[model samples]
Target: DTAVSQTPKYLVTQMGNDKSIKCEQNLGHDTMYWYKQDSKKFLKIMFSYNNKELIINETVPNRFSPKSPDKAHLNLHINSLELGDSAVYFCASSLSGTQYFGPGTRLLVL
Candidate 1:
């Protein structure tokens, strides 16, 4: 069983195409988040939700959106992707201060 899973470990596509990365967590946590890890390994918070309601939006572009069907799943969708959008997307959850992360989904734009 996977604690967290994100589809398409690597994605490469044209700049204008729309794409999505699915994420899920089974740790019974109430809060889940989407983060982007840049080439420097600095994890920046993009969005977060608790009980299916958004709790954080850290200056992320409107072209990027996140959806949570339930407490266990959070998915990201990007529209009209740009070359600057190329980065590693990660899903994470936290109960207190401890956070658990997914392997990450790498996106490349050409």
Candidate 2:
């Protein structure tokens, strides 16, 4: 689910490089999230981890990987970056059906 998401472009790397971002939530929430930048310049839910179960959208590419080491932290690892992967990745955590998102990390695969 998308909210009034914040998008801040920052990372720029070359193709074939691996990119990773870590997210942590201190609200005692039980779920962590990974979202992708939409072509419309918005953000959309791409992966969600809850109760040790990970739910990934089928549309997500194989180059992307999501990991949750614990309830408070989550990680998104991208391998072999492609030009198409250039976009902001939004990190979030949710509890009681409300989500709190980060400013987002912008990836540019050149």
Candidate 3:
């Protein structure tokens, strides 16, 4: 059984489009995170949710939003997508600071 899963693993869209990604974890972890991997393979945390409260990374833009309705699910929404926003988005669940990542959702902005 998969510990973490993401829906619509691939997305292709035009610039200025809005998109959302869904994630769920069965590990019963209290903390979940969203990460972005750029073309250069630099991975950075965008947002984290602990017990349904959000903790966003300061460097992340307001256009990126993360919502966690419960401990087992976290979803990401991006408004006005740009070319630079094209990247692999990963969802992770952590217990005691050790994280397990889901298969990434690759978004391509044309």
Candidate RMSDs in Å, in order, are 0.9, 4.2, 0.9
Candidate 1, lDDT over the whole model: 0.93
On the 0 to 100 scale, the lDDT of residue 11 in model 1 is 99
Q: How well does candidate 2 score on lDDT at residue 87? A: 81
**Candidate 2 local lDDT, 18-41, one digit each (tens):** 978777667788877888885579
Instruction: Report lDDT (CA) for all predictions.
Output: 0.93, 0.78, 0.93
Report the Cα lDDT for residue 87, model 3. Answer: 96
The ten-residue window of minimal lDDT in model 2 covers: 1-10
Cα lDDT of model 1 by residue, 15-56, tens digit: 899999999888998899999988788889999999999999
Tell how far residue 72 is off in model 3, in angstroms: 0.6
Worst 10 residues of 1 by lDDT: 92-101
- Models 1 onward score TM values of 0.96, 0.85, 0.96
In order of listing, the candidates' clash counts read 0, 0, 0
